[model samples]
Target: QQQVKQSPQSLIVQKGGIPIINCAYENTAFDYFPWYQQFPGKGPALLIAIRPDVSEKKEGRFTISFNKSAKQFSLHIMDSQPGDSATYFCAASIVGYQKVTFGIGTKLQVIP
Candidate 1:
């Protein structure tokens, strides 16, 4: 069953703009949240991740904000550029578990 949900099927932003993608999970057991970024004809790569213990995490231009009580999380892209344009997915899983539930996906376009 699908436990994670994401909003805004697609988004467009100008260069240097910030784009946000939101996600929510239904299972409280989910303790790990990760966001993946994929470019055309390539496998998805782990952009950033957060545990319930941390409210937020940042890596380079990517950041993840997590809400443990609400079972929600979001990804924020800072200084988004054309190269950053890609399909992003939010996923949740239990710690030490291989099964991951992923959101539908959000396509972002950074226009010059």
Candidate 2:
């Protein structure tokens, strides 16, 4: 239980549309779940996050749905916009661990 992976190397979400991407982890030991959003050539920034104690979390137009038993989670972009077009990554880490493991990455394009 130490690996998390995501799919759909890329996604296209029209203006004002919603785009969802799924992720699964192998480690149940992970307690901190964080989704990051990155612009072109930029470092990933924390978007929204959920702990295993919570089922869902939302921040502004971004939402994270989590499953504890299945060791799965997903990110949802609501009312997406062209400005929101960017790369997203799902990551996890155990408590007391400063390092986090990240997925390959997902590129999202919100067309206007």
Candidate 3:
């Protein structure tokens, strides 16, 4: 099986922050671009992701910690901005299965 090429998909933090989500995958079919956010009765939304050619995607304040060789990835948000408050469902999609397997979404409320 071929390894996923990117180490961390455009994830960087300018300063110290807390890590909230940790995802590890063994399946080669698992998506390299792993990011999905869903709401009640709503379709899954793709928030921040990078293309195959890019290794890092940085938006203001959003941070990510990823280890591609270990097949592990995590997300962190700095400042706890009001916009970050949401029940986030972090998930991975299997290419062949046509399914998204995720844990019970984590309801995060950061007030600062």
Candidate 4:
């Protein structure tokens, strides 16, 4: 139950493209879910996130959704621009246990 599966190893979109990245987990103890965005030579930064109790969340141009029963979640980018192109990762962790699990990753390229 410590593993998280992610989809679409890579994605290519236009300047105004909308891309979606999905992930699934099996552990129910995970209380925190976060989406991270990483550039070519930088560390991953927190994009948007949602808790198990939350159905969805939005921040700036990013959105995240979580399904408690389905054990799934996803990240969506609206009005994607070239700056949005990066490697995205979905992660899960127990609030107080300090245990975190991360998905493989999705490499996104936004063409101008």
Task: Please tell me which predicted candidate would have the highest TM-score against the true structure.
Answer: 1
Query: What is the C-alpha local distance difference test score of candidate 4?
Result: 0.90
Top lDDT model: 1
lDDT of 4 by residue, 1-112 (tens): 4389999889999988899999999888888999889999899998877888889999888889888999999998999999888999999999888777999999999999
Per-model TM-score, in order, reads 0.96, 0.95, 0.59, 0.95
Cα RMSD for candidates in order = 0.8, 1.5, 7.2, 1.2
Q: Locate the minimum summed-lDDT window of 10 residues in model 4.
A: 1-10
From the highest lDDT down, the ranking of the candidates is: 1, 4, 2, 3
- Taking the tens digit of each residue's C-alpha lDDT, what string does model 1 give over 74-106? 999999999999999999999988899899999
Can you give the lDDT of residue 59 in candidate 2?
A: 88
Let me know the TM-score candidate 2 reaches against the reference structure.
0.95
Query: Candidate 3: TM-score?
Result: 0.59
Clash pairs, model 3 backbone: 10-56, 10-57
Q: How many backbone clashes does candidate 3 have?
A: 2
lDDT for position 57 in model 3: 56
lDDT of 3 by residue, 21-90 (tens): 5556566455544555555567767666532334455566655455556666555665655445555545
lDDT of each: 0.92, 0.89, 0.52, 0.90
